[model samples]
Target: MRENSFEHYYTQKPSSSLETREVTIRLKNGNVYRFISPSGAFSFGKVDKASRLLVEYAEVEENDRVLDLGCGYGLIGITIKKEHPDITLFMSDINERALKYAKINARDNNITAEMRQGHLYEPWQGYEFDVILCNPPMAAGKKVWQEIVNKAPSFLPSGGKLEIVAFHNKGGSRLEKTMKEVFGNVRTTIKSGGIRVYVSLKF
Candidate 1:
């Protein structure tokens, strides 16, 4: 199960031998960013399509407090911060190795963000965010992703947005339904390459 599933990227401590590589991503807006991705982290060679879609489509505003839930190597949050410097950015991930690389990537890219290592939203229990963005761990099973959807409202103020990305055929449809169930409203704002970005506004 460990070898087949995405458990390695979702664990607090990954068992894989440490290996690192530098990845560069150029966004649609022509912004180029670099990140240090380690072995056992998700999307090690480049930013995955789902995450890139989330980064591009999610609505961020000036001075908004943004939480990048399940951030892997700081792709979404770090990129958003670079794009909108005024927004306060927070990033968290269950995987310690991912968090470590996220921190390094943040520094390397000259982006400032608060990073925490914990499962789901535990690291930010009492905090509220204006926007929460995620590229969920689909292979980690339903419970993990369900927790993210079910508990997101508690950490968001009324009218706050929660955005997540996945392949429509590969668990994205279920995620859209779950978000609608939790938040009472949901919409797909972006779709390309079989990936979809689902957005919900908390009431």
Candidate 2:
């Protein structure tokens, strides 16, 4: 495929060269995870800072049904399952290479998760989640990211939450505004690195 293009990771069948690497991420809670990332996935060589922050702060309960939208190599969802095994986790992405590694990572970690391949909420049409986590693909542009923010409510029940991380200069402000407009309430937790975690509750 196009080398390092934004659309490379969103392709259903990625044509990028098959190169793989293994990465270990140590979570804030001292839990460690190992993942296999291939060339055609986002953050292929390491765990992304935004995704790391999302997993660190995204609130999840023991029995919460969680959906990791656009889960690249299953970092967010797999980490959650590792911490709270009782929570049901679902991971979806459009990249086949990412999905393949996600399944492998989950299996290697001995974590149970449903991995589906589809764009944003399409594969999860009939499913509902108690918590949704995303580190949206900002390179995909505002319309794509905003669609993720806007469509989250329909998949969530009352009291359910949607949490996302974005760079302040890279659509975080717009995301906050969209969350406020869509969910009626939005809370932000900011980091010194200009990364903002936006949380919205469906009520």
Instruction: Put down candidate 2 lDDT per residue, 98-124, tens digits, no spaces.
Output: 999899999899988888999999999
lDDT for 137 (candidate 1): 89
In terms of lDDT, model 1 sits at 0.89
Q: Report the C-alpha lDDT of model 1 over 1-203, residue by residue, as the tens digit.
A: 64464866778898899988888779887889888899988887776878888888889999999999989889899989999999999999988999999999889888889999998999997899999999988887789889999999999999899999899998889989999998999999988999999999998
Off by over 4 Å in 1: 1-5
Give lDDT per model, in order. Answer: 0.89, 0.89
Candidate 2 residue-wise lDDT at 62? 84
For model 1, which pairs clash? none
Each candidate's root-mean-square deviation in Å?
Answer: 1.4, 1.8
Give the true-structure RMSD of model 2. 1.8
Q: Estimate each model's TM-score.
A: 0.96, 0.95
Clashing pairs in 2: none
